[model samples]
Target: MSGTIQFKQDLPPKGGYEPIRYKRNLPARGPGGLAVFGGILAICAYGFYKVGQGNLEQRELKRERAWSRIHLIPLLMAESDRDIYRREQAQLAREKELMKDVPGWEAGKSVYNNKRYNPQNFVVM
Candidate 1:
Protein backbone atom coordinates (compact mmCIF):
# COMPACT_ATOMS: atom_id res chain seq x y z
CA MET A 1 0.00 0.00 0.00
CA SER A 2 3.06 2.27 0.16
CA GLY A 3 4.82 4.10 -2.77
CA THR A 4 7.88 1.64 -2.80
CA ILE A 5 7.53 -1.87 -4.27
CA GLN A 6 7.10 -4.60 -1.69
CA PHE A 7 7.19 -8.40 -1.98
CA LYS A 8 5.30 -11.03 -0.09
CA GLN A 9 7.05 -13.01 2.61
CA ASP A 10 7.16 -16.25 0.51
CA LEU A 11 8.77 -14.60 -2.65
CA PRO A 12 11.87 -16.20 -4.18
CA PRO A 13 15.29 -14.51 -3.63
CA LYS A 14 16.48 -12.05 -6.40
CA GLY A 15 20.08 -12.74 -7.67
CA GLY A 16 22.48 -10.95 -10.14
CA TYR A 17 21.97 -11.76 -13.88
CA GLU A 18 24.21 -14.64 -15.01
CA PRO A 19 24.86 -15.69 -18.65
CA ILE A 20 23.79 -19.22 -19.67
CA ARG A 21 26.74 -21.67 -19.58
CA TYR A 22 26.30 -23.60 -22.83
CA LYS A 23 28.48 -26.77 -23.03
CA ARG A 24 29.02 -27.25 -26.82
CA ASN A 25 29.74 -30.96 -27.36
CA LEU A 26 31.47 -31.08 -30.78
CA PRO A 27 30.16 -33.82 -33.18
CA ALA A 28 32.57 -36.56 -34.30
CA ARG A 29 33.77 -35.63 -37.85
CA GLY A 30 33.99 -38.94 -39.75
CA PRO A 31 36.91 -39.88 -42.09
CA GLY A 32 38.07 -36.88 -44.07
CA GLY A 33 36.71 -36.49 -47.68
CA LEU A 34 40.25 -36.29 -49.00
CA ALA A 35 41.11 -39.60 -47.23
CA VAL A 36 38.16 -41.33 -48.92
CA PHE A 37 39.21 -39.92 -52.31
CA GLY A 38 42.77 -41.12 -51.77
CA GLY A 39 41.54 -44.60 -50.88
CA ILE A 40 39.51 -44.78 -54.09
CA LEU A 41 42.53 -43.65 -56.10
CA ALA A 42 44.70 -46.29 -54.49
CA ILE A 43 42.17 -49.00 -55.25
CA CYS A 44 41.97 -47.92 -58.90
CA ALA A 45 45.76 -47.91 -59.19
CA TYR A 46 45.97 -51.41 -57.71
CA GLY A 47 43.33 -52.64 -60.11
CA PHE A 48 45.29 -51.26 -63.04
CA TYR A 49 48.46 -52.85 -61.78
CA LYS A 50 46.73 -56.23 -61.49
CA VAL A 51 45.38 -55.90 -65.02
CA GLY A 52 48.87 -55.15 -66.32
CA GLN A 53 50.23 -58.16 -64.48
CA GLY A 54 47.54 -60.35 -66.02
CA ASN A 55 48.40 -59.08 -69.49
CA LEU A 56 52.05 -59.82 -68.88
CA GLU A 57 51.21 -63.32 -67.75
CA GLN A 58 49.11 -63.85 -70.84
CA ARG A 59 51.92 -62.65 -73.06
CA GLU A 60 54.37 -64.95 -71.32
CA LEU A 61 52.03 -67.91 -71.75
CA LYS A 62 51.64 -67.08 -75.42
CA ARG A 63 55.39 -66.90 -75.83
CA GLU A 64 55.83 -70.24 -74.11
CA ARG A 65 53.19 -71.83 -76.34
CA ALA A 66 54.84 -70.34 -79.43
CA TRP A 67 58.19 -71.67 -78.35
CA SER A 68 56.73 -75.12 -77.74
CA ARG A 69 55.21 -75.11 -81.22
CA ILE A 70 58.49 -73.93 -82.69
CA HIS A 71 60.31 -76.77 -80.95
CA LEU A 72 57.72 -79.34 -82.11
CA ILE A 73 57.91 -78.22 -85.76
CA PRO A 74 61.47 -79.43 -86.21
CA LEU A 75 60.64 -82.79 -84.60
CA LEU A 76 57.65 -83.17 -86.92
CA MET A 77 59.78 -82.31 -89.96
CA ALA A 78 62.48 -84.76 -88.90
CA GLU A 79 59.88 -87.51 -88.42
CA SER A 80 58.47 -86.77 -91.90
CA ASP A 81 61.96 -86.89 -93.41
CA ARG A 82 62.63 -90.20 -91.66
CA ASP A 83 59.36 -91.60 -93.07
CA ILE A 84 60.36 -90.47 -96.59
CA TYR A 85 63.81 -92.08 -96.25
CA ARG A 86 62.24 -95.32 -95.01
CA ARG A 87 59.85 -95.33 -98.00
CA GLU A 88 62.76 -94.81 -100.40
CA GLN A 89 64.75 -97.60 -98.75
CA ALA A 90 61.72 -99.96 -98.94
CA GLN A 91 61.24 -99.11 -102.64
CA LEU A 92 64.91 -99.84 -103.38
CA ALA A 93 64.69 -103.18 -101.52
CA ARG A 94 61.58 -104.15 -103.51
CA GLU A 95 63.30 -103.26 -106.78
CA LYS A 96 66.35 -105.38 -105.81
CA GLU A 97 64.13 -108.38 -104.98
CA LEU A 98 62.20 -108.07 -108.20
CA MET A 99 65.36 -108.13 -110.39
CA LYS A 100 67.39 -110.54 -108.25
CA ASP A 101 66.75 -113.64 -110.54
CA VAL A 102 66.72 -111.71 -113.82
CA PRO A 103 69.88 -112.29 -115.89
CA GLY A 104 71.76 -109.10 -116.95
CA TRP A 105 69.19 -107.01 -114.95
CA GLU A 106 71.45 -105.39 -112.38
CA ALA A 107 70.41 -102.28 -110.30
CA GLY A 108 71.69 -99.68 -112.86
CA LYS A 109 70.85 -101.82 -115.94
CA SER A 110 67.19 -102.22 -114.96
CA VAL A 111 66.64 -98.45 -114.70
CA TYR A 112 68.49 -97.84 -118.03
CA ASN A 113 66.68 -100.65 -119.86
CA ASN A 114 63.24 -99.37 -118.73
CA LYS A 115 64.05 -95.88 -120.06
CA ARG A 116 65.48 -97.14 -123.35
CA TYR A 117 62.83 -99.82 -124.04
CA ASN A 118 59.91 -97.43 -123.40
CA PRO A 119 61.33 -94.88 -125.87
CA GLN A 120 61.90 -97.52 -128.56
CA ASN A 121 58.30 -98.75 -128.34
CA PHE A 122 56.88 -95.21 -128.88
CA VAL A 123 56.50 -94.34 -132.65
CA VAL A 124 57.72 -90.90 -133.75
CA MET A 125 55.41 -89.01 -136.19
Candidate 2:
Protein backbone atom coordinates (compact mmCIF):
# COMPACT_ATOMS: atom_id res chain seq x y z
CA MET A 1 0.00 0.00 0.00
CA SER A 2 1.15 3.57 -0.90
CA GLY A 3 1.86 5.96 1.93
CA THR A 4 -1.03 8.38 0.80
CA ILE A 5 -4.38 8.54 2.67
CA GLN A 6 -7.63 9.07 0.68
CA PHE A 7 -11.20 9.41 2.05
CA LYS A 8 -14.45 8.99 0.08
CA GLN A 9 -17.04 11.75 0.56
CA ASP A 10 -20.61 10.60 1.32
CA LEU A 11 -22.00 13.99 2.44
CA PRO A 12 -23.46 16.61 0.10
CA PRO A 13 -21.14 19.26 -1.43
CA LYS A 14 -20.58 22.22 0.94
CA GLY A 15 -21.42 25.80 -0.12
CA GLY A 16 -20.55 29.21 1.39
CA TYR A 17 -22.74 30.34 4.32
CA GLU A 18 -25.87 32.28 3.38
CA PRO A 19 -26.77 35.40 5.32
CA ILE A 20 -29.81 35.03 7.58
CA ARG A 21 -32.93 37.00 6.62
CA TYR A 22 -35.33 38.45 9.20
CA LYS A 23 -38.58 40.44 8.80
CA ARG A 24 -38.21 43.94 10.25
CA ASN A 25 -41.40 45.30 11.84
CA LEU A 26 -39.86 48.14 13.86
CA PRO A 27 -42.02 51.31 14.27
CA ALA A 28 -40.81 54.56 12.68
CA ARG A 29 -40.87 56.26 16.09
CA GLY A 30 -39.06 53.70 18.08
CA PRO A 31 -37.89 54.54 21.64
CA GLY A 32 -39.17 58.15 21.34
CA GLY A 33 -36.30 59.12 19.05
CA LEU A 34 -38.68 60.21 16.28
CA ALA A 35 -40.81 62.11 18.77
CA VAL A 36 -37.76 63.98 20.04
CA PHE A 37 -36.64 64.76 16.51
CA GLY A 38 -40.09 66.06 15.61
CA GLY A 39 -40.14 68.22 18.71
CA ILE A 40 -36.78 69.76 17.85
CA LEU A 41 -37.93 70.48 14.32
CA ALA A 42 -41.12 72.08 15.61
CA ILE A 43 -39.19 74.28 18.03
CA CYS A 44 -36.81 75.44 15.32
CA ALA A 45 -39.68 76.15 12.94
CA TYR A 46 -41.56 78.15 15.58
CA GLY A 47 -38.47 80.17 16.40
CA PHE A 48 -37.97 81.05 12.77
CA TYR A 49 -41.64 81.98 12.43
CA LYS A 50 -41.49 84.23 15.50
CA VAL A 51 -38.39 85.94 14.20
CA GLY A 52 -40.13 86.55 10.91
CA GLN A 53 -43.21 87.91 12.67
CA GLY A 54 -41.11 90.23 14.81
CA ASN A 55 -39.38 91.58 11.75
CA LEU A 56 -42.75 92.19 10.13
CA GLU A 57 -44.09 94.01 13.18
CA GLN A 58 -40.97 96.16 13.41
CA ARG A 59 -41.30 97.06 9.77
CA GLU A 60 -44.95 97.99 10.22
CA LEU A 61 -44.18 100.15 13.25
CA LYS A 62 -41.43 101.95 11.36
CA ARG A 63 -43.77 102.55 8.45
CA GLU A 64 -46.46 103.93 10.76
CA ARG A 65 -44.00 106.23 12.49
CA ALA A 66 -42.76 107.51 9.16
CA TRP A 67 -46.32 108.12 7.98
CA SER A 68 -47.24 109.96 11.17
CA ARG A 69 -44.19 112.17 10.87
CA ILE A 70 -45.10 113.08 7.31
CA HIS A 71 -48.62 114.11 8.37
CA LEU A 72 -47.71 115.61 11.74
CA ILE A 73 -47.44 119.25 10.60
CA PRO A 74 -51.11 119.67 9.70
CA LEU A 75 -52.29 117.80 12.77
CA LEU A 76 -50.15 119.96 15.06
CA MET A 77 -51.40 123.16 13.43
CA ALA A 78 -55.01 122.05 13.76
CA GLU A 79 -54.50 121.17 17.40
CA SER A 80 -52.93 124.55 18.13
CA ASP A 81 -55.82 126.35 16.44
CA ARG A 82 -58.33 124.31 18.42
CA ASP A 83 -56.52 125.16 21.66
CA ILE A 84 -56.56 128.84 20.78
CA TYR A 85 -60.28 128.69 20.00
CA ARG A 86 -60.96 127.06 23.36
CA ARG A 87 -58.93 129.69 25.14
CA GLU A 88 -60.87 132.45 23.37
CA GLN A 89 -64.16 130.81 24.25
CA ALA A 90 -63.12 130.56 27.91
CA GLN A 91 -62.09 134.22 27.90
CA LEU A 92 -65.43 135.17 26.36
CA ALA A 93 -67.30 133.26 29.06
CA ARG A 94 -65.26 134.97 31.79
CA GLU A 95 -65.92 138.36 30.17
CA LYS A 96 -69.67 137.67 30.05
CA GLU A 97 -69.64 136.94 33.77
CA LEU A 98 -67.62 140.02 34.50
CA MET A 99 -69.91 142.16 32.28
CA LYS A 100 -72.91 140.94 34.26
CA ASP A 101 -71.18 142.11 37.46
CA VAL A 102 -69.45 145.31 36.11
CA PRO A 103 -71.21 147.08 33.25
CA GLY A 104 -68.03 148.02 31.27
CA TRP A 105 -65.29 145.56 32.44
CA GLU A 106 -63.31 143.98 29.55
CA ALA A 107 -63.36 140.16 29.31
CA GLY A 108 -59.57 139.92 28.89
CA LYS A 109 -58.91 141.81 32.17
CA SER A 110 -61.38 139.66 34.03
CA VAL A 111 -59.73 136.45 32.84
CA TYR A 112 -56.28 137.75 33.80
CA ASN A 113 -57.52 138.68 37.30
CA ASN A 114 -59.29 135.36 37.87
CA LYS A 115 -57.36 133.24 40.46
CA ARG A 116 -58.40 130.08 38.58
CA TYR A 117 -56.37 131.28 35.57
CA ASN A 118 -53.20 130.36 37.45
CA PRO A 119 -51.28 127.76 35.39
CA GLN A 120 -50.78 125.68 38.52
CA ASN A 121 -54.52 125.46 39.04
CA PHE A 122 -55.17 124.08 35.52
CA VAL A 123 -55.98 120.36 35.64
CA VAL A 124 -56.23 118.53 32.30
CA MET A 125 -59.31 116.65 33.35
TM-score of 1: 0.42
Q: What is the lDDT of candidate 1?
A: 0.73
In angstroms, how far off is 33's CA in candidate 2? 2.0
Per-residue lDDT tens digits of candidate 2, residues 1-125? 89588888686447855656677876665448788899999999999999999999999999999998988989898998899779777766865765777766665543365566433334222
Prediction RMSDs, each to the true structure: 13.6, 11.5
| Pairs that collide, model 2 | none
- TM-score each candidate: 0.42, 0.34
Cα lDDT of all candidates, in order? 0.73, 0.74
Model 1 clashes, total count: 0
User: Which candidate number would show the highest TM-score if scored against the true structure?
Assistant: 1
Candidate 1 per-residue lDDT, tens place, 80-112, comes to 889866765676677678778988775423335
Give model 2's TM-score versus the native structure: 0.34
